[model samples]
Target: MPMEKTEKTLLSKKELLEIFVNHRVDSPFPGDWESVFKGLGYEFWALRELEPTDSFKNIDWKAKARTGKFFVRDFLAESYFNVMILYDVSRSVQFGRKELLQAHIAVSLAYSAIASNDGCGLILFADDIVKYIPPRMGRTHFMEILDAIVHAEPVRCGGTSLGPALTKLLNEVPESLTFILSDFLYPLDFGYTFHHAAQGSTKHEVKALQVLEECEIALPPGTKGILPLYDYESGRTVSLDLTKWQAFNDTMSRQREGTRTLLGRAGIDLLTVSPADDFGRKINSFMRRPPSTY
Candidate 1:
């Protein structure tokens, strides 16, 4: 069923803190968050036969003495990296309880990254970049991010300018694990832009969280006759025939599948979610699972 429009308001500090606490309790992420996310760092990788070029400093003396063969301990490079969150504040996202859900997801991710001792940054965008915060760590930085999410408002005009935002991220932001949260209702060459972002000198580990309303996916089960559907981004209303709801669902499904395919080809992950989903669990699973598993 189509949900009633929700009131737009700022989330109080108490509410935000409650959400964070709930997420912490529900999340499956371990205390050593870095262990789950493998990357270059001081973390021990493995032991392998030592080669002529291998540094003697890394030699495993015990292993060599036991096996009577030269072996060296391999360590992963520094795994510390920033987590950049690109949030869409376009008008379309304000539909139903989407913005609220988005807030939860964003806040949870920010807190998780910070808890993992990683720097977290944010970029809020509508037709263009509305605000940008460089990645930083510490409790104070987390508060700043929480404050931004709490006060975030959807832009009253213009469509999503995802392309422009990606360009800015590529040009300015350092390589990081980037998550783009949006409804993805706008028409843009997602393949080209995402592929570009996932490759080259500024390559980043990009992922997407597509937040959508149930009604946007399909009309109510008993829907009938013509309905006036409003385009929030454009501030226009168009009549939609309820009889063609099946067709509408098919079209929306195809669009979503197309997006998923495009992003997957670029080695990026995409997770579609609704306002009622368990965001903390979903996020934990998404982070832990491989892209192919999606």
Candidate 2:
């Protein structure tokens, strides 16, 4: 169920497991998710940790950890991967291009992670993490997660509040093999919270990757006259004069620079991708050579 409409389930653990597993085995990924990944890489999955509920009484929502070995014949290499994905459910993610890419890139990457035998899970966050799914092996777990992610719903409307979200991840995420997927609008204290979380427990293992949209950063010329933009969730609209494109461009540049600077100071492994860009290649290129793994 989407966070916007988290549904109440009415099934037993055995029933849920049976259905989840059968779905995976029958629906083997359409793409050869394993081929793209090279050598051994850590896969990160953000999981929800919650009490047993009616819908999924059998579903285990904890940050469980595991290690596995795999060998790629073509690469003539064997390595280990610990991978997880942390996604922001903030209203900011509800915006333009960046939002679409999140659905495409993040979801695809998670599949690759599972194929690599790397533990993968999901992190659903707003002002705070709503749930944590512990990373584990098996096709059933992976497919179930992929389904949930593909169906994530919008939460409450609020200006990209990530401090609480990061805090939740900090408290629960098992390791650094985690890959953060967000626009990272860069709010105050949010950076500090993320930095502290990165420094806490397993330091330097967590990596921050930014997903952005092209239009937000730059605009085409002749997009003249007055324009208005509205928040997807809040429905708040702001008017802008087309003649100010140049100024808007300049200001956006400054914002980008500032975001990069702050992220650098925080020592976060930073990556920004646009929706127009080749979503898969960008992520594969960076992860093809992870700095380290557990």
Candidate 3:
């Protein structure tokens, strides 16, 4: 499929808002959004007279002042879940139209979550965590996330450090339906990190969306001679023999399969998306599918 010309880069706020509106009117997922998060978290239930065993932290100070009685807030386990987007702003993702694709996917999911009254958060990272917005539910919060994504630029020097980013998320954030969006072009081995994060005390539901350009997967047809490729993160260039295009394709294919296998074993679903694909619909389909088990 041909790429949409307008989507070759991140869209403006107006464009993003339009997409959000459309998604609310015509959601692609099948059942109610609440069903997607069954058995996940809790929501506020009610307030009742404070019991002797109730902690002082739960006491409603305002209620005590108003009615001259102690009351404590209560919660119920429910369908609420945090939707966290961990985006890679590393130089590698600066490749042809990858960031644009990331923005589309992130915006769609954030809007969907907020529309369903679920909390949505964002973490932008490269060599480390660049920015983080804790999961929150509101139009203002969604706009903050949208602003961060639209203005996000790739880090100028360092390669991706997904290990630290994942570590931070696992340690700090609550259990969430987390989505990692990146090109997965870094050389780091983060398989163990992913495994630990998925199976940690929090038991986060992790998913990954690998954004890539079509040419990155395979060289153009009828390519010949030496092709010079530049490494964005390293500021280095390497010459490749086009005669070895098939070898390059084989290596890339293996790398992709290896990633899928590793994340699958960690119980994380992996979806590879390209600028030419219908990413919104693809993301909806991916979300509908259950996470893979080891």
Candidate 4:
């Protein structure tokens, strides 16, 4: 018998989109999926009472038959879309094995947004706002945003804060789709800040992409040794005994649950992906899916 060898080829943007369209989640989050991925063109409005000037092509005959009333489909022409990408460049992101993965995810989404004729913006933040590239349409602007994020320097700070950066975004950009990408390992009080940020967005939808390392998610069951962990953001060093390590893992578990709860309550759609998962598929799952109305 002969041996078989396989070569892996890189997937193009078109191929990635095909995968998304061909395969859908079991139960998609209820949202306006068509408007989110289709970019600028026309949006389907609710079926309403037919007007004298309404075209026959736009008429919803099924609705007319079912409800026993004349109704016509309405469409609103949308010129363009503004997609704001908020990526965390705190030192903590630079510490793990998946250091560059976060940027890759951000870059992918940014590419998709721009390719779809939407204005893509970049906001690199840590404890404070590091850099802000206002949303602009075109390949050149998207490339500039990508370059800034890929070459960004990690900040040395005590912790990550979304309040100041989000507050700034709320004040500057209006009616944009905001994407916040981070590991989200922050202090307890930061939750309040998150709630405040989400609450303040009146006309925008917030999509959260949480990047986490495998170890951060959970430890092996047999792990029973002392461990040395470093806080990259604060430049602090700490030694943990076996008991303390378990407690730390417990705290991380609780934090994950708390984060899910907080974001859910704020009506934010969260997609948690890890380095171990298929990056393209996971990203497509998040970006291409319908927004959650829950």
* Each candidate's clash count: 5, 24, 0, 0
lDDT of 3 by residue, 37-65 (tens): 43234566678887654567768899999
The models' CA-based lDDT, in order, is 0.71, 0.57, 0.74, 0.66
TM-score of 4: 0.68
> What is every candidate's alpha-carbon RMSD to the true fold?
9.3, 13.7, 13.2, 10.3
- What's each prediction's TM-score? 0.72, 0.67, 0.73, 0.68
Alpha carbon deviation, residue 243, candidate 4 (Å) = 7.8
Worst 10 residues of 2 by lDDT: 1-10
Identify the runs in model 1 with alpha carbons over 4 angstroms from their true place.
Answer: 1-14, 17-78, 189-198, 220-222, 292-294
The sequence of per-residue lDDT tens digits that candidate 1 reaches over residues 56-175 is: 777899998899999877664355778888998988988877777777667767776787778889999888888888899976797788888778887976667787677767777767
lDDT tens readout by residue for model 4, 1-294: 011111122233344344434665232211113334442236776787866544567679899889999987655436576788888888898766344666656666676666667788888888889999998887678668767865688888878988776776777787577888888778423332223356564555677788888778877665677778888976778876655556768987889878876776665667776667665555544543444443
Error of 4 at 25 (Å): 28
TM-score of candidate 1 versus the correct structure, residues matched by position:
0.72
Which candidate has the top score in lDDT? 3
Q: What is the lDDT of candidate 4?
A: 0.66
Position 94, candidate 2: lDDT: 68
Would you give me the overall lDDT of model 3? 0.74
lDDT, candidate 2, residue 236? 81
